[model samples]
Target: METEGVFQSLPALPLFLLMFSIIYLIAYFIVFRNWSPSIRPEASSCLISLSHGTPAVFLATRAILAGQNRGFAASNTVFQNLVLDYSIAYFLMDLLHYLMFFPSDLIFIGHHSATLFVFLTCRYVVSHGAFAILFLLILAELTSACQNAWTLANARKGDVEFAAKLYDFLSPPFYALYSIVRGFAGPYFVYEMLVFFMTGVADHVIPRWVWISWIGVVLMAISVSILWVSNLWLELYRERTKKLEKKMR
Candidate 1:
């Protein structure tokens, strides 16, 4: 009886794969085929342009200061250094998302939304993930620049005050909310992917190329995490600088 039960269970894998494949094919043909093109590439380009341009403008202003012997060289260095740090952070995070999240989402979700909730949730996950990571990188850079500006102001006038205290006060709560939502999304995605795999549909409908893409995505995610850690180190460095400055005065 035990052997028979085991044998019977073995066939479920193929069945699961079959069901998943059929559903995926139908969705791909009927739904995805008709949907509007994604604007993600445009958004990504805009973000890169904004990030690169911000530092360029700062550097240009400092260059003018340096010409006048007003301590602008140091300012230029500060801005350039922060830009390099942020660029690296952005690259790594993007690489990771492409490698891990993209593949996992495609394999599991694949544009199959049976209800409005699922569809909205899927869109939110993909969009919010991109926006949040970009926002985090930008915020880190802005924070670093603000700290630097504060230090410079104090050096010149003997007192320093942050201009955006209200904004800073609100950031923590928003960041917390973003983290909570993003944290749960990953596990839920994996669960759904597992369900599709068990149904044997993943193997049947999802081409080999798609599977290969997923593997690449996983590798990218790992790379992104590594970069994120480096970015955190910069944050720590900023905090340490603040503490040291307080001790000095």
Candidate 2:
């Protein structure tokens, strides 16, 4: 596949360092440095630190899983390949979110007219940039889990269907809460929208046909949202019916 060829042609080390620097900068400036004194009076709380560390923890766990799987060898070549792929993908999105989209806040906030533009812009930039990185890290973990399920199915006669279902069940609530907070409660929905667009760009890893299959899955998710709404209404109706029956009885 040209996947290897494309990755090999890039400057892997520099890109990796750049990606790491972006991650660090976002963590320090946004989460740690700007953390309100009202939230914490002393050293950062464990919860706060863990919240900041979640993305790294998630990625490190995935790397460990990938190493343990014989299919993904822990040798130098495998390490290099994974580093190159992730570094390129991560850096491209990081640059897009931090460098490109962040500066546009000036235009949206009226640059000079809005007195809060400076603070809002900083908050918006950091939140959105962190979100993009976090989302990509989650996707990487999910992809690894999917690969692991396939490996188990082929090599060990495991139930791939069960693994897939379990992963699916867990993903939605996480994504729902993330989407809500990132969309509604955060600085601006525009940032979340941008993150969503960047995610679509990152899905370029697969061939066109395979990518279309992913789009179909996304469409199915939209349908599922409709069904979820219907189900909620049905539950409410059933509860009301039970109450009427009890009153009559």
Against the true structure, whose lDDT is highest? 2
* Candidate 1 lDDT tens digits, 69-116: 322011122222233333433333333334443546542232121111
In model 2, the number of clashes is 0
Error of 2 at 140 (Å): 14
Cα lDDT tens digits for candidate 2, 74-174: 12233334433343344343333334335554432231222122212212322112232223334333333333333222332233467445544434444
RMSD for each of the candidates: 24.5, 21.9
Q: Give model 2 RMSD, 1 decimal.
A: 21.9
Candidate 2 pairs with clashing backbones: none
Model 1 alpha-carbon drift over 4 Å, by segment: 1-184, 222-226, 233-241, 244-249
Query: Candidate 2: worst 10 consecutive residues by lDDT?
Result: 119-128
- Please report how far candidate 2 places residue 218 from its true position, in Å: 2.0
| Candidate 1 vs. true structure, TM-score | 0.28
**How much is 67 displaced in model 1, in angstroms?**
62
lDDT of 1: 0.36
